[model samples]
Target: MDFRIKWLVSVLLIFGGILFCTAQERSKPLVKHVVLIGSDGFGAYAFKKAKAPNLRKMMENGAYTLEARSVLPSSSAVNWASMIMGSGPELHGYTEWGSKTPELPSKVIGDGNIYPTIFSLIHQQLPNTKKGASYSWGGIGYLFEKNMVDIDFNGKTDEETMQKAIEFILTEKPSLTFIHFDQPDGAGHNIGHDTPEYYKEVEKIDALVGKILSALEENNLMENTVILFSSDHGGVGKGHGGKTLLEVEIPWIIYGKNINSKGKLESSVVTYDTAVTIAHLLGLKIPDFWRGKPILEAIKYEEK
Candidate 1:
């Protein structure tokens, strides 16, 4: 072939190759990344009346349960561990604030609860896809299992924790992320569970939620992610670790493309079901030890 014709043929081949690569990249299924958010002291009553436009949008766009309940005494350590381990007060051990357990020696925060965190499980199973990413969950200064887990930001303020969360999801894009906001809870204990602080802090946290959502949107990871919003426990008469509604009652919202938007919650659900739910959504089997049902009701789409 002449030089001119050969050059033209090479150019067409390169263009075709580019188009083919683009098609393949676009065709790949979006990976399922779990982002669990905890709004401290955000109860059903507070959630219902809270003037949070972002939370309202999440409730409408996804799913919301009026009867969500936290762990016993509604303490952060118990509930967070329960949700991650997919166990109850019996299995996960640490069932109260400032864990009385003689082990771990660390403060009874996010890490004191004894159980397999969702992060540890997925990191072990999905190592190839996970890329060993660094993350900053909502709770700050708490130590959980360091086995393939990062809890750099634990028990921090609403804005601070959310900033860390957004940064982690945007920068690391972790396969699993859990965020806890100790706002209303920390504020609630000082001045009654249902005081002005609860309302004000919840609204503040809601703004952070919107900001995080915006980050996800900008990164184009909204559709590819599974979001879980819950609480450690509610506060009654100042602090939690009680069975009362003010302490145990919570609000649950799960949204994202992998979930079923219209699913209805049912039948005595608790924190134990959360970890299994995340595992189930990620196309992974619940471990034999995970004595919790996958909240099939909250899931909008049936896993195939």
Candidate 2:
């Protein structure tokens, strides 16, 4: 009888230890890498008719919203700046669509005399973390502090840009990677939003997204990686920078490890929220000056 009791106690202790270890692992941050993909002029409305199976799969498996809003004026540079800087143009001060520098002085300038951005925050907190940015737009290069980035590549086309981003991810295994595609915006400007040609451009971008996903999977980075997809702004007619719903509303999608498979997000998401979300995933300190809040509902682990 004493032998049986001892055996039972041993089994209980082993089981208890396993449970404790599992809980501890769950409480720790699960995301080790983050890939942020931004598509210029890819509006939320495009999903209404655009047959983007790959993006649709991400939306179904991850937390997403078609109602995420852009900052006022709904332009490229201002909204892109807001997305990474965690504040509006009032704080980050890139008010114009073609703004190469802050039209108004930034509310808080960090190490490089540039407004505090996600890249800056990550660099300050995780000094050894590899960071990379690949974009087809030349204007995007000027928004953040280049000195903090390890690899900054500007490709002549969206295809080339994403290809370079894949190469960087495979070779460098960067902790954070931001990719910007300039198509669909160029198509929207040259053609017209809501037109058939614009939809085609969005479809092409979707194919590019598929390629990126494949690369991540091939390199076995998907297990520890989280991907967030968003846009600078939507468009209406042949141009943007307006107050129309078609121009202000954008799509936001988050997928991968530690993300709740909440089909669609109900919470209100803004451009600045992207930065805060990335910071939260990487376990970095979100600056008090930033106006954005992390999308906690999409995360599986309870942040303490």
> Highest lDDT, which number?
2
Q: What's model 2's TM-score?
A: 0.90
Model 2: C-alpha RMSD to truth?
9.9
lDDT of 1 at 166: 75
Clashes per prediction? Answer: 14, 0
Point out the worst 10-residue segment of candidate 2 by lDDT. Answer: 20-29
TM-score for all models, in order of appearance: 0.78, 0.90
| Model number with the top TM-score | 2
Candidate 1 accuracy as TM-score: 0.78
Per residue, candidate 1 scores C-alpha lDDT tens digits across 217-244 of 8889987887788877776667667777
lDDT of the candidates, in the order given: 0.67, 0.92
